[model samples]
Target: MPTLSDHEILTELDDRMQMFIRRQEMMFVATGEPHDGHDCTFVTGGPGFVRILGVNRLAWPEFDDVSLSDAIADIRRDPRISLLFVDFARGAIGLHVDGKAKVLDDDAMRRAYRALNLDPSLDLVADRRPMRWITVYVEEAFLSAAGELV
Candidate 1:
């Protein structure tokens, strides 16, 4: 058996990975604090809801109705987070992204929203317009195709 190191996992998003992320409509987010139990939630949106901000950064909007207080609180205390995206319909593959996440303020949220340049033709649900944004600074990314992590 081979051990995996941080260097072995991809830190930047490649073209194919970016496409995979953009096409997925849902993602599972996991967060935990040092002494507290972990929380996992599923967030769904239009096809391109999550956007890649940079090679090592990604941001996703949080709608008003969704309760992310637990996750947000955990992140504030301990920034560690993991996001999982699976191609259920097409490729049947999954990607695991581990990073530090921060809840962005109004200004930052607006900026991130605008940066996405979403298509006007797409009818985004009125209520889903992002009350806030969570930006993840990616540290390590593992692809299922490479191998299982545990």
Candidate 2:
């Protein structure tokens, strides 16, 4: 087993980080612009909402809600984004990923997810439906323990 040194930031998702991601149902996303500022939004889904495509890759769908349009727009312009995943149910174990993102339509997301049925959880999108996916190329990843952050 590999041990995480203090204050170390990983460029790829280690086994523990991957496990954490698989259990998380929600994440907070921060997208920024060069001059203006940043927008922080919450993304929610059912089981396995976030798919780990590779060691440094993650994929999550975006529904058709107009409220999310701005986040997509920011990604298009800057591609620099930060994501925070915290599991409060389990003493607030957390993961933070900083990456560049690209927007993909439904078809693209399906192909990337490698399944015809890209389930973004039913109830959340049952009526509105997903419009696109935010594929992130993680540049930095950090893990936070139960009581203290690392």
Candidate 3:
């Protein structure tokens, strides 16, 4: 296993992030918890946007304050996170991202969100609330394909 660098993150996300976000059809997000100290993982894709930056950070556009707060609070306690992309039609890929996560509510990020077409949508067309983005700070990342060691 090798540590993921900032430059490599930029390249990988720029090239392959979209495929995971789009082609995979679904993804699982795992977050850290301060209570039980166990990771909380959930499947999220429908009615949500996955935005990747570099290798470590990920953001979701158009999330409400309630959901955003929950995600941010967990990140504050545990920065480690992992995202899994499963391609039922083909092979599978698991992307492990070990870093910090932050919920950002900034105008610049909002603009970028719009530019990237990662805006919040209620029905994939209607503009939604908050328009926040979850920024993941990457410490390490590993990619494993099917039948390979993860």
Instruction: Judging by lDDT against the true structure, name the best candidate.
Output: 2
Clashes of each: 0, 0, 2
Q: Which residue pairs collide, candidate 3?
A: 9-54, 57-136
lDDT of 1 by residue, 1-150 (tens): 233753347777766777778888999999998898999988887888788888788887665534688898898999999999987665567888999999986466665567655443342565334566789999878677543323
Q: Tens-digit lDDT track for model 2 on 1-150? A: 343665458889888888888778899999989886898988888756787888999887777757667888899899999999998887777788999999999877777677445654543566555678889999998876635432
Clashes of 1: 0
Which residue pairs in candidate 2 collide?
A: none
How far in Å is the alpha carbon of 38 misplaced in model 3? 2.3
Candidate ranking under lDDT, highest first, comes to 2, 1, 3
- For all predicted structures, in order, the TM-scores are 0.81, 0.83, 0.62
**Residue 133, model 1: Cα distance from true site in angstroms:** 0.0
- Models, CA RMSD each: 4.4, 3.7, 5.5
Candidates' lDDT values, in order? 0.76, 0.80, 0.54
lDDT of 1 at 1: 22
Query: Clashing pairs in model 1?
Result: none
Query: Which ten-residue region of model 2 has the weakest summed lDDT?
Result: 115-124
Candidate 2 vs candidate 3: which has greater lDDT?
A: 2
